[model samples]
Target: MTAPETVVPTGKSGIYMPRRSLLMRIADMRAWLFLVVLIAFFEVWSRSAYGVSFILNTYNLQSISVFATAPLLLALGQTFVIISAGIDLSLGFVMGLASVIAAHVANYAALQLGLPPLAAMLVGMLTGIAMTIIPGLVNGWLIAHLKVPPFIGTLGMYGVARGAAYLFAGGMTISVSNSWYSTIGNGRVLGIPVLVILVAIACLIMHYLLSQTRFGQHTYAMGASQAAARRAGINVKKLTMKIYLLSGIMAGVAGVLYTGRFSAGAAQAGEPLLLDSIAAVVIGGASLFGGSGTILGTVAGALVIAVIQYGLVFINVEPFWQFIAVGTVIIISVLVDQTQRRFTGGRQVE
Candidate 1:
């Protein structure tokens, strides 16, 4: 019997870096650079005094930046799913359910009867976790056991989850009755929005999970080929379940954060998030076909989407034009992915 090999070391500074290490580093830098350039671009545009008067408004800048943080979290989760040769349309709906949990926690009859606040929050988080687990399990079942196509399986789950959200909340907007609940969502840390901080933390954890963990290693292997992965003794079924489980957990967290910021829970919680998350993952350099991508790429993709949406508002563009702009961004990103695929595929053939 032999232990499975998962990681290789690349010596630093005095030693030449390995190609894989270099590629990974390049990917990380590219994602961060994308975000930096975008923020800078918008900051300059806001100061241009001629390009977009709306951009110059401090209140709008803060609002746009804060809102971007939520979608960015979704993008990070989507990036992981796509790289591992999967998709999750349920992220939007899962978020809605989580939002409901957050709202209902503070309103619990037991809590109102003098139960501790922390206990209520813990209860909410647990509920959110369970919500994500079921869909992920189903996705895993359909994809791994039933041999269903990832796209269609997840798309079906998407509709099912949204309906569940509506049912769970009785199709009405639910809000927290406590000031403590509102504080967590709307509060800032060191002059930065708490939601943005949460997104950054989520990205960091996910990056390490994808880049350094054993589970993450198998993720790529299974994505590269289930047959090969199984031959290598990797548990494809287990890994598939775990991956979708992770997607659900992340979506659940995002949902909670969004509920906090909005101070309400609604069935429509994450409707616009579905395509944007996919776009973020695609933009981050994760391929639809699976086997390649980084978390950094996802955050970058998300920031790009956020900037474009914000930039539109800054320019006083009509509200409806936002969809057109987002569609253009997604198309451009996918085109880039296809072009890269073709070039690499040709080289391999040659």
Candidate 2:
């Protein structure tokens, strides 16, 4: 390897800085690059194989964005947990629980209690979001207070949540009759999906929380090193609780949005999204071992998955390939993360 030669200035020769190679500089943006590459590949494939433009179609773009919303929302919260060196497997079912609960509550409020449709929908949304706190607290207590491993604690909660969701739904889907609710779920604003617009707003808020606040700073500190963060006067336990709680809320939000989009709440609403959520976080450049990730990267990762899913169908690929494709990306991400860590001598880099 050749290092850049130092160039001394005509008047000042004391200062010379090493310039980073192009690869190193763009390492953080790998997710975006992957997304671009996938889009280009799919566009070419569609043109040649199907005699149509894949990415240029309005319907295809909208469908991809909508497909991404659920996973992206789930991944947003997962981003925080993973950044703190933890995971929350329960979030997927926590979303299911919220969905079922939201649909039931909305029905009762509107039909039984004689509340207005719009108000009932709002009530249901709030209650559904609030219901996730129970599981969040449980996972937090186990991991933060009892010293249980995050994976185990969250996995346990995952079963509990799954069971509860099915129980609430009575082993079936609950459809909402309210027209207002349906509109919220399926409606578009200025040619954009309401769900997509809502998720975009959520992404902005999460980005602020993760990148601009003291809490975010503390989260990074904890993920990088719990003991070191504690020694530096950061409260690791409280932060852990907050992280899981935030994660639960993220899942809950996704669930409510699910209800709106589908006009029905299924106990398994988020069952298949677990892998996609994790994949988005990983492909977005977050290390599985923790301590690094970004909201923007996660957005790109989710878009990459969505495009692959939608594009594959557009070009006549089997549905099962989506899983394989996403898993491959995840493996590559981990390998890249490990290599980057090695290059950095084990220091966490953003």
Best TM-score among the predictions, by candidate number: 2
Candidate 1 per-residue lDDT, tens place, 1-350, comes to: 98877445546434654234454444434545555665676677666756544445666756776767778777777777887788888889888888886677646733565656555655665676567778878987888789888889888888898888888899898876555455667877776777777777888999999999988888988777778899999988888878888888888887877777777876678888878888888777777778878886787778777777877667566767767866775676666556555644522211
Clashes of 2: 1
Alpha-carbon local distance difference test for all models: 0.74, 0.91
Model 1 spans with C-alpha error above 4 angstroms: 1-45, 50-62, 109-112, 345-350
Task: Tell me each candidate's TM-score.
Answer: 0.83, 0.93
TM-score of 1: 0.83
How well is each residue in 147-222 modelled by candidate 2, as lDDT tens digits? 9999999999999999999999999999998888888888889989888899999999999999999888888888
| Model 1 local distance difference test score | 0.74
Q: After superposition, how far is residue 42 of candidate 2 from its true place, in Å?
A: 0.6
